[model samples]
Target chain A: MSLLTVGSVAFDALETPFGKTDKIIGGAATYITLSASYFTKENNLVAVVGDDFPQSMIDDLNQHGVNTEGLEVRVGGKTFFWSGKYHNDMNSRDTVEVQLNVMENFDPIIPESYQDCQYLMLGNTAPSIQQMVIERLGKRPKLIVLDTMNLWIEIANPDLMSLLKLVDVLVVNDEEARQLTHEYSLVKAAAKIHTLGPKTVIIKKGEHGALLFKEDRIFFAPALPLEEVFDPTGAGDTFAGGFIGYLAKTDDISFDNMKRAIIYGSAMASFCVEKFGAERIMNLTQSEIQERVSEFVKLSAFGLA
Target chain B: MSLLTVGSVAFDALETPFGKTDKIIGGAATYITLSASYFTKENNLVAVVGDDFPQSMIDDLNQHGVNTEGLEVRVGGKTFFWSGKYHNDMNSRDTVEVQLNVMENFDPIIPESYQDCQYLMLGNTAPSIQQMVIERLGKRPKLIVLDTMNLWIEIANPDLMSLLKLVDVLVVNDEEARQLTHEYSLVKAAAKIHTLGPKTVIIKKGEHGALLFKEDRIFFAPALPLEEVFDPTGAGDTFAGGFIGYLAKTDDISFDNMKRAIIYGSAMASFCVEKFGAERIMNLTQSEIQERVSEFVKLSAFGLA
Candidate 1:
């Protein structure tokens, strides 16, 4: 099974308590594809970047086994650029600038080779665009996991709500979950969001952890407690990448396996926060991932009987 | 093994989002002893309450296997009274009034029988008083656990720091951990606190969960997500009690066993917030406890391998 991710593959400039970064490779699809590549060699990206995007970055993704055959390069167009300044806590950030030159008129063209993708990851993107990618698929993927932000849930809620019915899983931060469902209690908010259609709801709480809710079962995965978080810019996108990547590689969608996927996602996100953008996670060895996963086991493992 | 708890045993007026309660039985020791009673029948409570306190509450403690012979009823004095209004989120509350009547000049007299206690839990109280109890004890308990609040960290910090050196474990919420050690990262905070004295530090994060750090090992126990939180008063004390009670009953203080104790503590605290005061926890049957513990297992259980 292959993993297909659709979202932004652009550039970003970030300032954090840990220092600042110049225009670097940052974007949901970029991270998702890069992260998923670690687990599966057949990661395909369906994102549009302008000719201004560096060719070396694409070669970097290619080195990680991420296929960019479906990544459209618009000639003479500027790649989407975003700049943000992080507060001391590194939990919240303020957007300094946004240049959506290429994304403004973006169109995703699914490669014929990508038609066999069984695990589809719709990274944080416009609701209309995410749905368009899904509608264009020759056939529905075995599993569809969608991630969204408060922006779409507020201004494009109708479109977002309609698209939710077609996805198998939905992932959002805790604050976004509250804003989307208008319920403060995550347990209550999860139930309410279930009515909007995602059978599985994942509420990411940044440093706190992530919660997985479905039917009558819920699983909590704690984020690794680190001494310092250099940058949290692409942690969530990397988490989504790790999640679907594991699912695609293992080809197991049971609730139990989803819990394992959540842990893997958390482990990936933990690495993402250790460095600016995706520096730490870009070259994680299999042993490093296994060691981190073992730490999670020790962190949460306990027996009552 | 017997469990001895020393803290306020008094009345409280509470208002939550669900509703309000008139003067009801509430106190750190009250909740601590009651929660511990479910695990160990040899639970001993030593606290001063005014004659204004009803005898029925004493009988209630007796019915729950909690020994009240050490409880001092100061005739002509008033019971400690606390009133608070909970915000919508139930995480933060504003104390409207505090009448430290009998508690103002409280003296904990360790009953001759309580001297045999092997496990001691110091509930939220003045660090001076907590240290006094440890000093007066005939022999140091096998394991001493101290729970404190932010007030002590601010006002009685010197006394608290001295007591921390004598205790085996120290329990405080996330904020107090930061306040006590001046470290924001819990991992860092726990390390600094360990140098201060206690080898074990449990940082409670309310609804999020709790983290236990000892030696080089750390364990995280997630709080059971609830649809509604009726009241949050004394939840922390309940956790401490359950933790100590389980440790005493099992007579195992090893790191592995402490992990199980934390899960039990979290499960007990989950019940504490389900109703006003300690109503829900007071009547919990053994079967109910086992069921809830099972729920905790299910809530956090996942297989990665």
Candidate 2:
């Protein structure tokens, strides 16, 4: 099975209580593809970046088993850059700058080889661009997971609504889920979302945890309680990657398997916050991941009999 | 094994998005004893109420298998009363009025029979009063679980610190846990609390879930997602009651047993918010409780292999 990810791949400057960072390689697709590489070898990235982007980062992706053939490089254009400052509580942040240079008119040009992808991940991007990527596919993927933010739900609601019907799973934060449906209760918000589209909904509650709602069944995964969150740059994207990556490797979409995938996703995300950017995730061993997964089992495991 | 609960049993008037309630039978011990009654028949209550309090509610407690011999009624005093308005999000509320008529100078006198109690629950109250109850005990109970509020943490700092050393387990909400230790991270907060005393700590996160930290292990229980939360008053007390009650009934204080106790406690709290006051918990059948516990098993159970 193959996995395709299409979203932003750019530079980010971040400031947290711990310290600040210079321009670091951080983006939805970058985190997604890099994270997916840990679970699957046939991970493919379909995102656009400017010529100013470092070739070393692309080589890093290749070394991690991510195919960068579909990643486009625009000549003589500035790379998409974002700068933000996290509050004392790392849960909320303020975006100080966003330059959508190459991302201004990102056309997700699907490669012929990517037509074999069975799992497609539409990372955080404009709903219109996400829809375009879906339409350009030669054949629909077996599973489509879409991640969106409040900005799209507010400004491009119509596009987002239509795009929702085309995807199988919708991933959003707790606030976005409430804002999108105007329903304070997440169970009710998920029910309203099911009416529009996306039968499966994952509401990420930052440090609290994540919930998976499908039909009449619901599953919850707890976030690992860490001593400190050095930087929460791409935790959500990393979670999404681990989720779909495990699914692609296992090739199962049943609710039971999704439960296991969420645990894997959560384990990956716990590592994402350990250091700045993707530094920790970039250098994880198989045993380290297995040990982390076992920690989750220990953190939540209980016997009833 | 007998369970003793010592706290306020008074009246509450609540206003919420769903509707409003007149002065209904509400208090920490009212909810705690009522919830624990479902688990243990030897449940004893020690609290002071006014003659103005209804006899029907006392009879209701007796009917629920709770021992009311220790519940004292003062002829000339009025019952403690609380009034609050829940915000649009039922998570936060505004305390509009408080009349500590009988509770102003309350005395928790341990009865001869209650001295045989193996488990004791000191519900939310002044830290000084909670400590007095423990000091009056002839012999230490097998297990002591204490629940406290932010007010005591703010005003009675020394008393709370001393009380913390006297208890086996401590229960507090996420905010209070953070405030008590000046640590934003719950893992760190629980760690800081360990040095203050109590080997076990349970951090309640309202609708999010509850986390149990003991020794080097941790366990999480998810809150059942509901369509609506009628009232959130006394949910934490209900959780504490269910937790200690189950432990008393089974007479097991091990960490593994505590994990199961948390699940049962979480299920009981799920039923607490379904209606106003203690109405929903008053007449629950054994089958309903078992079914709800099974629902929790379904909500959090996942397989890795």
Candidate 3:
């Protein structure tokens, strides 16, 4: 099974109470491809960067079996750049700067080879761009999972809502779910989301964990309690990558398998926050992930008889 | 096996976004005894209320198999009363009034029948009074679980710290766990609290669920996803009641049994918030509770292989 991920590739500068960094290779597509590569070898990414982006970074993706043929490079434009600061709590953050640059006119060009993609994951991007990629596809993938933020839900209401109907799974944080449905209770929010589309709805609650809702069933997976979260830069993207990637590899979207997928996603996101950007996610061994997954099983395991 | 519950029995007036309530029979011991009564016939309550506390309330406790022999009546005083307003989110609340009349000089008096109790659950109260009850006991119970809030941790550090050494288990919310241990990460917070004295620590996260920690093992039981939370008062005490009461009924303290106990506790707490104060908890049937516990088992069940 193959996984296709489309979003942004950029440079990020981050500052946290623990430390600060400058211009680390970061973006939704970058984290998604990197994290997904661990589970599925045929991880294809479609996004636009600029000549300012390092060739070595593209080579890095290739080394990890990430097919970057669909990644466009605008020779004269700058790569999308963002700067943010994490608060003392590490749960909420402030985006201090964002330069659209190469992403301003970005239109994903899916390669002919990617037309046969089996799984599609639309990272956090403008709903218009996400829908455009879906329309460009030659045929529907086995599953389509879309990730969006509150900004788009508020500003691009029509586009975002229409995109929701086309997705098999919709992923958003707690606040976005509340904003989208105008319901404070997540159970109600999820129920409302099911009516919109996306047989599956995932509400990400940072350290609290992720909730998976499929029809009437719901599964919750807790984030690993870390001693310190160095940076939360790409945790959500990494989570989506681990999630859909595992599903692609297993080729089973049953509610039971989705529960395991979320556990893996939580494990990947846990590692993503151990360092700035996607540094930790880039080098996790299968055994390491297996051990972390075991922790999750132990963390949430109980029996009734 | 017998279970002894000691804490305040008072009245509370609450206002929430859903609606407002007049002064109702509400107190830690009241909820604790009522919840535990469902699990054990030998549920004994020890606390003080005023003559203003109606005889009908005593009859109600008796109706639930809650022995009120140890409950004192301050003939000239009014019952302890608290008033609070829940914010829109219902996560945090604001205290509007606190009238500790009979509770001002309250002292728990254990009845002769209660001295043979095998389980002692000290509901949220002043650490000094909790200690007084423990010192007056004829013999140490097989297990003692204590519940306390941030107030005691902030104002009675020495007392709270020393009392932690006396109990078999301690229950506190996520914030209080951090406050008590000075560690933001709950995993580390649980570890630090372990060094204090109790062999087990249960960190309650309200609607999020409860985490039970014993030595190197950690178990998390999630609260059932509800359509609405009518009221959240006394949820923690009710949880402690169901937990120890179940343990007393089974007479097993193994980690595995504690895991089941927490699940049962979570089910009881889930029902607690379905209606105002203890109304929902009072009317739950054995089959209904078992059904809710089955839902918890289903909510958390997953396969690793």
**DockQ of predictions, in order shown:** 0.80, 0.82, 0.72
| TM, every model | 0.99, 0.99, 0.98
Docking class of 1: high
lDDT of 1 by residue, A111-203 (tens): 999998899999998999999999999999999999999899889999998999999999999999999999999999999989999999999
Stretches of candidate 2 off by over 4 Å are: none
- If you score just chain A, what TM-score does every candidate get? 0.99, 0.99, 0.99
Q: What tens digits encode model 3's per-residue C-alpha lDDT throughout B191-228?
A: 99989988899999887888889988888888888879
Q: After superposition, how far is residue B231 of candidate 1 from its true place, in Å?
A: 1.0
Of models 1 and 3, which has the larger TM-score?
1
Top lDDT prediction, candidate number: 2
Fnat for each predicted structure, in order: 0.82, 0.82, 0.70
Model 2: residue B45 alpha-carbon error in angstroms: 0.5
Candidate 1 lDDT by residue in tens digits, B94-176 = 99999999899988898898998899999999999999999889899999999999999999888988999999999999999
* Residues A261-303 of candidate 2: C-alpha lDDT, one tens digit per residue: 9999999999999899988889999899899999888878888
DockQ-sorted candidate list, best first: 2, 1, 3
The ten-residue window of minimal lDDT in model 2 chain A covers A296-305
The local lDDT score (0 to 100) that residue A46 gets in candidate 3 is 98
Of 1 and 3, the candidate ahead on lDDT is: 1
